[model samples]
Target: MQIMDVLAKLGGESGFALFFMQGGWKNLVMIIIAFVLLYLGIVKKFEPLLLVGIAFGCLLTNLSYFLGHGENALYHPEIWANFLDPQNTAAYHSYGYIMKNAGLLDFFYIGVKAGIYPSLIFMGVGAMTDFGPLLARPKSLLLGAAAQLGVFVAFFGAVLLGFTGPQAASIGIIGGADGPTAIFLTTKLAPELLGPIAIAAYSYMALIPMIQPPIMKALTNDKMRVVKMEQAREVSKTEKIVFPMVVATFVILLLPSTAPLIGCLMLGNLFKECGVTERLSDTVQNALMNIVTIFLATSVGATMVADNFLKLDTIKIVVLGLIAFAISTVGGLLGGIVMYKTSGGEINPLIGSAGVSAVPMAARVSQDVGRKYNKNNYLLMHAMGPNVAGVIGSAIAAGFLLSVFG
Candidate 1:
């Protein structure tokens, strides 16, 4: 009798027994999804730096749910739900309850909820970026602005599909092809959609090499792709130092909501260009960026609770995000084609495809495509103009959306 009692107790506590209880099937499904994401990040090397952490966070969060009835659970969506409820004044806009009752992942999530991680990531991006190409050719700004056509297009599409205004705005920003900007905007406008939006945004960004080439080919003829342009005039160090200050002041004054992202971005760039803060620039580029990326990716993934992520809305968001991203690429290419025609074939239309803010990746694609047509053609520096411009343009688009909906 004693032996049988011990065996029964063990069986009751086993994961096998628990697997059949408490909607464990949903957890199982989520665990499978986590494994797939892990495969993509590890084996396929798809944004491995962030996707790997995100996959692990998803795995940990789902596994913790198996012991959710006890204190062993690492995250609790109920706590966040209460925090988002304005009517629940005791829980709303306060972290006191969270501090007392939260778990490990919940603590990490604080940075994401408070909008710290993405803004800091922008600082790192600014520190690493070179704006000489942009200042050399201001026409690239128009290409970057044209790429934002997809942002508003996606916005209207989401609205027609039944999302609320804030939700639609969050969906629209994914078209910017900028992961940090998408996260920053979504957290403010639609935190509930953060998981899907972040996932979709980063996934599409990783697939830029595949998604952009087809669009580039379809939009332009070989002659336009092979066109070579004259070199831009040299930019002085004084101009480089002054550009960030002027941009930050003008943009922030025009759109006060843009202060956090724009201010941090310009500060990082200043640190790089001013030549007086090498150490600060280095830290922001390497240490600070890597640390925040881990925290941000994991915390964003923690929100992918089975109940929230495995829904029809997620499917819709994924489709809409793809459409938005694709359209943005098309818009940029069209802008390049226009420049080619207007410049009398002096500018390569392929450079316009780099205007989606994927940084050097999109610009490199332009170079590759241009080289295929004319071995002597060099579009990298030219493409960098629009590539960097896309960064500023996307931030501005996020600011505009926030002003309207946030």
Candidate 2:
């Protein structure tokens, strides 16, 4: 009788019982998805810097539902739900209560909830960026603005599909092909959609190499793609130092909502260009950036619980996000074509696609495509103009949307 009792107790607490009996089939599906994402990040090297952490987080969070109850679990959905509403004081209190009771993932999620990680990431981006190409060819700013056509286009599409205005706006910003900007905007406008929206934004961003090329080819003939731009003029150190301040002042005065993202961006740029704060700039670019990225990616992934992520809404978000990215690429390509004709074929139509703000990746694509046609043609520097401009343009677009809906 004693042996039978001990055997029954062990069977009740077995791993098989814990996994199969605790959570439903959805947990198994989510685990499979997590493993697929891990394969993409690890074996395929698809944005491994963030995707690995994200996949691991997803795996841990999903497994938590079955692994144990109470404090042993990595995430607690009931506790997290209370913190989703930013405007509710009681929700904030509940968040505090849950944080004290829950595991460590809840603590790290504060960065996502309070909107600190995106700003820090922007600071790192600014520290690493060079605005010399943009300063040399200010006309590239127009191409940046043109790429934002997709944001509004997707906004209307989302609204037509029956999403609320704030939700539509949050969904549309994914077209900007900017992860941090998308996260920043979605957190403000449609916090409920944060998980899907963020995943869509980063996933499309990683697939830029595959997505933009086909669009570029379909839109332009070989002659246009091969068009070579004149060498950009040299910008002085004084101009570099002054550009960030002027841009920050002008943008903040025009759209105060952009202050958090744009202000941190300019501050980081100032640290880099001033030539006096090398230590600060270095830290912001490397150490602080990596630390924040780990926290941001992991927390964002944790938000993808089986119930939230497996809905039809997530499928819609994925489709809409793809549409947004493709449209933005088309917008940039068309803008490049116009510039090419205006410059009498001196501008490469390929460079305009860089305006979608995938940063050096989009610009590098332009270079690769241009080189395919004319080996001597180098569009990298020229593409950089619109590449950086897209960053500012997306932030401004986010600001406008925030003002309207937030």
lDDT of 2: 0.86
lDDT for model 1:
0.90
TM-score of 1: 0.96
- Candidate 1 weakest ten by summed lDDT: 65-74
lDDT of 1 by residue, 2-43 (tens): 999999998987656767887778888988999999999999
Residue 271 shift from truth in candidate 1, angstroms: 0.8
TM-score: which candidate is best?
A: 1
How much is 285 displaced in model 1, in angstroms? 0.4
TM-score of each: 0.96, 0.94
Residue-level lDDT tens digits of model 2 in 19-70: 6674556777888998998899899887888888788788877777653343
Candidate number with greatest lDDT: 1
